[model samples]
Target: MLINKSFANQAGVSLIEILVTTLILGVGLLGVAALQISSLSSNQEGLFASQATAIAEDYASRVRSSKTSTVMPNTNISYAQFVAAYHNGNNAPLACAAAPAQLCRSDAGNAALDCTLAQLAIYDQWEVCSAAQEALPGGLVRVLNNGIRLTIVVDWDSEQGREDIGNVAVRNNNCSPLTGSNTRNCVILELVP
Candidate 1:
């Protein structure tokens, strides 16, 4: 029996076509995997930024509410004193573990032991700074008062391999960079309170 010439040629062409298709599919799948990895990295960066913003906003809100007469003394404690208490030299926050016993109370039993304005301010700073440290890797806080505006700066270490040097430089303009590393992320919030 003689095999048809057309049948032999068609069989060889089909095998070649399948091999080519598989190679293309493999390349496409690899591209998709890379895209997935990049997306996850971007999401993580966004989460860090969101956390920073929340921390700054929360502290600002605390300051705003602290302006009421109930929170501050009528004559002894000025708003300036409250603001001054938060001035950290761009360093890690003082440990809240040493916070005054009155400041840590959750029950009405401590209502008579009202925290002084200075102690309240310190407590607020500790609360915010501790949150930043816990939420972000290598996180830090700095409060700066330039006689006119108050600035709250929160910074943290950027994830490894995600450092865009140009972006880091731009983001850190108002805040100090992390020690020995240019790869840091920061958020700055300026407030009058």
Candidate 2:
């Protein structure tokens, strides 16, 4: 074994060694910065996911609260009549059908074009029955209505890929997606409390 020189005894790193170390440090620093960026992006997505989940749960709870009194807005028509009109095989008049996808009174979204993450969230609802949701009352009126179903669908474009995830029906106190010129998405939740 040879004696080793202390750092004080050694004058300094050779130029070649210094260059190699600098290259290594530079690469390492870049890797760390990339990790930081990725972490921030992941955190942002988690926050959005939490917010979307809260929105979904809120609507679900609202449906549960008003299960018995799912009265349609039109006073003279009556709940049964509106529901029957809603459930019929033929598309109810445009007065009822919500928006794009032309899915009776429910699939309404921001506009004919938007399809935003928020809009997609409500648009993806599915029904429990063999028929389309349009064939049922535009909203789920049960706390855990087996006859109706909802799916909160969210989508966004990112460098990695397109993201689309949804939660199955959650009980609601009432239906909502209330008043708007762009009522399709709202109609999806309209009846919820």
| CA lDDT of every candidate | 0.68, 0.35
In terms of lDDT, model 1 sits at 0.68
Error of 2 at 87 (Å): 11
TM-score of 1: 0.75
Q: After superposition, how far is residue 45 of candidate 1 from its true place, in Å?
A: 0.7
Query: Model 1, 6-113: lDDT tens per residue?
Result: 677763547778999999999999999889877767777788889989998988887776667433446676666666766654544445455455563244555535
| Candidate 1 weakest ten by summed lDDT | 165-174
Residue runs of model 1 more than 4 Å from their true location after superposition: 1-8, 12-14, 70-73, 89-101, 104-112, 160-181
lDDT of 2 by residue, 1-193 (tens): 6767575488867899989999999999999988986666666455444443444455454333223233333355443442332222232211213433523233346233443322332332322211222222232211122123433222212222212222212222222222111212112333312
Candidate 2 positional error at 84, Å: 9.1
TM-score for all models, in order of appearance: 0.75, 0.39
